[model samples]
Target: MTAQAVAATTRPRPARAWRAVLRLHQPALFLWGVFVTLVSAVLLWAYGPGGNAAGAAWRRKCTVDLCDWEDYSVDRYHFAFRFSEAAIDFMPILVAAWAGAMLIGRELENGTAELAWTQSVGPVRWLATKLTVPAALLTAGTTLLVGLHRLVFDTQQVPKGWNWSDNGTFEANGPVAIAFPLLALALGALSGLIARRALPGLIGGILANATATTLIGLAGPHLVPWKISVGDLKQGYEAPSGAIYGGEGAVTSTGAHIPDPCSGGEKACLAAHDIVGFYSEYHPSSQFWPLQLTETALILTVTALAVAAAFTLLRRRTA
Candidate 1:
């Protein structure tokens, strides 16, 4: 039991384990996280309190014209969801999934698990540490992002909405939503193990996670425990520009503006009484916490399942 040997034996291998975890960082996932973070920051700055010079000028002009400066100003509540949509909503999940897929997928693909596990910590410990780093990073990153978004976007008049809550392209993939990302990472890690190629594993992770999100987003409303509806919240949920004539019920961005329709005055004259108000249809205030927690639970549950499966695969690989 020499001092040098004892010190070597006692040193924990967690750092190395994390290295193994991060070694799988794929270009796509890293880029996704970086791009989303940068974009969100820009959007937040643009829409934040007195965001841009033009916005300040508009507010100043509106204040001079209107009696109540506050009334004319586009406050947080007025553009809550829109700002959140641009700022901090759906990117975290993508980062999470990319990390998850890279976590075990890349190792499994290149058959580097054996080398990683040969360290003092066995395969299970190795995998656990690797998973921990990204999970921890994403959690910290997402928490900060969500908090920033709330500070900037959360408003009483307006509400905090999510890509999960909406049915638009902004709909979060697995890692995007807390619960969904857990499931997505699980699928991706598993996919990596089975597919064992970077591209295939990434695709597999995306497809499986996307399918799960779609199912949950679309069908979760109908199910129990996962129910996320805003009954009376729909009161103002009408399309921005009231209703469209001759083109289904589709409402475009312009319709939401509080002005007379420029549609040749045909529809304007017909529904002369119809005026677009600067109102938010999706009231996220009431359901913000509920939806966030629900989505978080889903991500955790899926993460648990994915971790279990990943360990099993690792065990089998090392066995």
Candidate 2:
């Protein structure tokens, strides 16, 4: 009942909990290390020699209004760049699947979780440790990869082969890349808790994350207000550089918008629709950070909710 003894008893053993989690999941941790290492190596190569060779080839090919179609120096860099992008893009799926099948699912299925709960760990701390460790690992690995990917990408290319708004490129270039895997981790942990079986947890986690991913992709363009570019009848419409195009249409003098009235140079056809101008709607380059941050916020919000739900479910079950 002494104050010193009471304080000692009350102090949290986070290190103990973390050590247990890491020891139990050492295989997964090793695999993740390998994954990050391999990805970093390829990306570093692409960021340096690969990028320089491609840039030089591109420069050589574009000068004097003439081009060398056989210049193959760009191929190696493109392969590395594309592979790295694809890996990061699919990272959420991989993380979710592994978390569901291995992290919580296997433990629950074999009664290991109950064993831990009985050993004074408790369900809430257990689940928190499960989520926290992986989230930290994921964040670090993704931040490094995203930084390297941004370096490997050539933002200065004329005509921009891989635009910032491109699907894989967009995800790999910002904090959303980091947020997505965390979201996936939450989704998988929740799914594992709900299913309490390895196989079903694996399937449910991947499907749940897939659904969220698709929804996010569909909502990305709408996250930021569309900027419109309009041109008079005497001129044509084209979006500004670095803009992510949404749609286009013809504009009437009365401010009504409609589809293009003609494409065969038929002036009378245009007049029939009362079209007096054309317009393009897009997210301009300035909106890039806004869009990226908005998506990251949305994803992290869901991630927090999922983690909360997992804890709630665990507490209810244990109580």
Candidate 3:
């Protein structure tokens, strides 16, 4: 073979060429991304600075009672509702799911993989180049999301968003967090190599991603070593659903009164029973790193396994 031909066979194209691959997949990514931002905007707008109708009602009721004054802050409400965590949780899976379906599988379905492989590049290099764009874009998008979340939480007067307990950090680290969509992308890529059809690729990608997302979200904390505890009601105050004790002159059996604390009298101190100003025995803020590291490890492990499996499958098969 000519030296030029030999060089072409041995060396992969510049990674910058992968931009074409990323551009091809942008539409799929955009469609799924809307949901992530939509949910966040709705939740923040609803329960943000002036959005707490529900929280306000509960606080007002406490004013009539003798228990303690209820402090209502957007950050507290955001943490209570877990909106930021949900945004982080959903984005990766959605992105990966669509990519898996349309990018790898669809190309295979159209019998384009063979053509792609038969080009100047070999199968592996072609696949790598295709993946390069998506991977970079995914990393950029997620990092931006994390930054936005940090900005929102830190700028707020109340410390409401991005609690260590809510699984917010894990969502940003796509490689570690059972990120089903990313796995689906790999799976679909492999399947496209093996199955070679658009419909099947789409079906397989959707099913795999959906199932994995559900299973991971349900079983992740337990199957892996988890340091954060969710339902510890005994230590200080437990209100998962925002279960307020006192409101607007109404009294609970606990004799919990709300406004008595702010009533400008010594009576408020005595009435502030079961107020949620103390720490839970299993508080997450104090032990954030252990949980973060463990969960991050779990996610990265799963991602690595999936990528390995996909690579193995691709190596033996034609795309």
Candidate 4:
């Protein structure tokens, strides 16, 4: 064999950073796999047996004005759906906690991350690997769960399910679920990088993500243009079916929207304000995907910022 060929054969292979990250976080991966499996099973059950049984029970037992509370089938299916949805919704925050405590913080706290840095992997590459691998997995898993959730919800219909405006339902219905968990992961990374200890990172991750989430939730309805519906004062105001109510008020001749002059429906008060018509601003159900995607975009934007900050912090610390 030639010397070059012998040297090439003898050369050590570069370490697989991603594989190391995976092996280190194997327990988390296993837990997530179990969670996804159970949630998928629950959702599938809801989509098939649970949905059919509830629908039939409702029709037979209490299809009238009032539903019978006796049959456990309705309650069982309802609880399962609710519980499953809640779990899916909570998974992101849980991801945040895990990412902060285990993924980044624990490594740094134990000097393992620094030890890895002394190896061939640079800090930037290490942080990037730490983020991207989990992010891809999280996004794919959450997206599937969201799809299953929507399927079950569509099959069950209303009363059994919820309106699009419903809090957890709305979030779980779209890319928001996928994006927000990435955001949570990013926030957790930032927290871990900042705290450099597992316990503090976990707490900081949860609080930071919670704050960001609350802000996002508060701003969700206004992310897209609100459909303004106007009607003559003589006729009461009405929004489209399955609309997310923004606010309602009196519309004057100048087209100015103002709060209700008489909330109690007092005729004299309505006349005193020169209320020519009533106006309501809402988002129709047709805008579901638009609103969802917009919110996803917003959350992803924040996630990008968090990840950038984490990188910047690491760079400065290493430098």
Best by lDDT: 4
For residues 174-250, write the lDDT of model 3, one tens digit per residue.
Answer: 33433334555665565555556666665665666667656655554444332322222233233233111212222
Span of ten consecutive residues with least summed lDDT in model 4: 155-164
Q: Which runs of model 1 end up more than 4 angstroms from their true locations?
A: 1-15, 19-40, 47-93, 96-101, 155-179, 223-285
For all predicted structures, in order, the TM-scores are: 0.59, 0.88, 0.57, 0.93
Residue 305's lDDT in candidate 4: 97
Candidate 2 clash pair list: none
Q: Which ten residues in a row have the lowest lDDT in candidate 2?
A: 153-162
Lowest lDDT 10-residue stretch of candidate 3:
242-251
What digit string (tens of lDDT, one per residue) describes model 1 on residues 53-161? 4355454555434434444344533354354444444543464356445666666667676665565668778666765665566566555555554444332222222
lDDT of 2 at 291: 95
Q: Which candidate ranks first by TM-score, i.e. highest?
A: 4
lDDT of 4 by residue, 1-319 (tens): 9999999889688779989988999999999999999999998988888878887888776754678577777777887788887997898889899989999999999999999999889999999999999998998888789889989887773264467777788888888888988999999999999999999999999999999999998898889999999988667797887778898898877889888878627778777888788988999888898899899899999999999999999999999
The per-prediction CA RMSD against the true structure, in angstroms, equals: 10.6, 4.1, 12.2, 2.3
Question: Model-by-model lDDT, in order?
Answer: 0.50, 0.86, 0.52, 0.88
